[model samples]
Target: MSNRPSPLNDWQRHCVRRTLERGGVIAYPTEAVWGLGCDPWNEDAVMRVLALKQRPLHKGLILVAASVAQVEFLLTPLAPELRQRALAHWPGPVTCLIPDLQQQIPTWVRGRHASIAVRVSEHPVVRDLCNTAGMPLVSTSCNPAGRQPARSGWQVRRYFNDRLDWLVPGELGHERKPSRILDIRTGRRLR
Candidate 1:
């Protein structure tokens, strides 16, 4: 394994940029587990992630960001309370279903639902990746459904290998479980 210490390292960033530019899937560390992601707007890239995990499109996908601003494009007009609620939990492991403003978001992303799942990640690598990519990415646990999520870059490679375009080396944050998913409108936990 390479000894690079940060996601911003030249070689690591190069790998991420190249794979994303080519509309390819990648695996990177998240708060709880490794996550598979790609340019959310790239249908081909999104399809690759779905196929790799044998995930149904109807289940939808999550978008992870460096900041709430990166995903603001997807949110509808919100009440002050709602805005504060979101702001209070962001930059952490909370995924919320917010109103989808741009009806143009592909079904492969929003699935059969009208809202889109989004999170402003606290993990440094994930945050930096979204910043570097200049857009939110389709985020999902780096494993097939019914399986445990990957926790290391090697585990990611072991699960995907040549099937993925790249595996961004990094460490998972200090969480033993996956992120909490909530319905912003209803304030209910989905997962």
Candidate 2:
């Protein structure tokens, strides 16, 4: 098997970044399947993703970042030892719920909670997109509320059609399951 990335050209990356910059939702491959993402700070964009998935806002969404530092603000409020634990497990597929201090996280991103779900993604395109777009992205499985997540770009298109502003071309990673979401404060595996 080749290690080559899916043919996502520089131009397409730029286009997707611009779309997110303008508060548009995009579909892209993740560790397990294709995911729909938008600028977490953009309430309207986050709503668009929720509407696309037929997901209730109160269920919340995950924020994927290029690096732990990109999402450090949310975890900083945790106890020093807890913060270290969250940091130690990151730069991977684990999503951790961290307390959102400063309340800087948008309600749309955190939903009806005081904590935010966040991960420093190991996927190359996701990292590049976050680094280029300059913020964490609202990440959610690409499909309606009850359906299985789309596993390929074709599947993403079938699910969303023209609803997505951009269908970012890429291949899913080798993981068979979604990231294991952990509640860092309680040591509970939420999903």
Best by TM-score: 2
Instruction: Encode model 1's per-residue lDDT on 1-191: one tens digit a residue.
Output: 12434567877788898889999898988999999999998999999999999999998999999888886766537666666666767878999887675575788898999888889987889977887888889999999877889987777878887898888877889988999988877889988
Worst 10 residues of 1 by lDDT: 1-10
lDDT of each: 0.85, 0.85
Clashes of 2: 0
Q: TM-score, each model?
A: 0.92, 0.93
State the lDDT of candidate 2 residue by residue for 1-191, as single tens digits: 12536355789878987898898999888889898999988889999999999988888899999887788777767789789878877888999988787787888878898888888888877887787688888899999989999998888888889988998877788889999999888989988
- Candidate 2 lDDT at 92 equals 86
Indicate the residue-level lDDT of 30 in model 1: 91
The best candidate in terms of lDDT: 2
lDDT for model 1 comes to 0.85
Q: Which ten residues in a row have the lowest lDDT in candidate 2?
A: 1-10
As a whole number from 0 to 100, the lDDT of residue 140 in candidate 2 is 94
Each model's backbone clash number: 0, 0
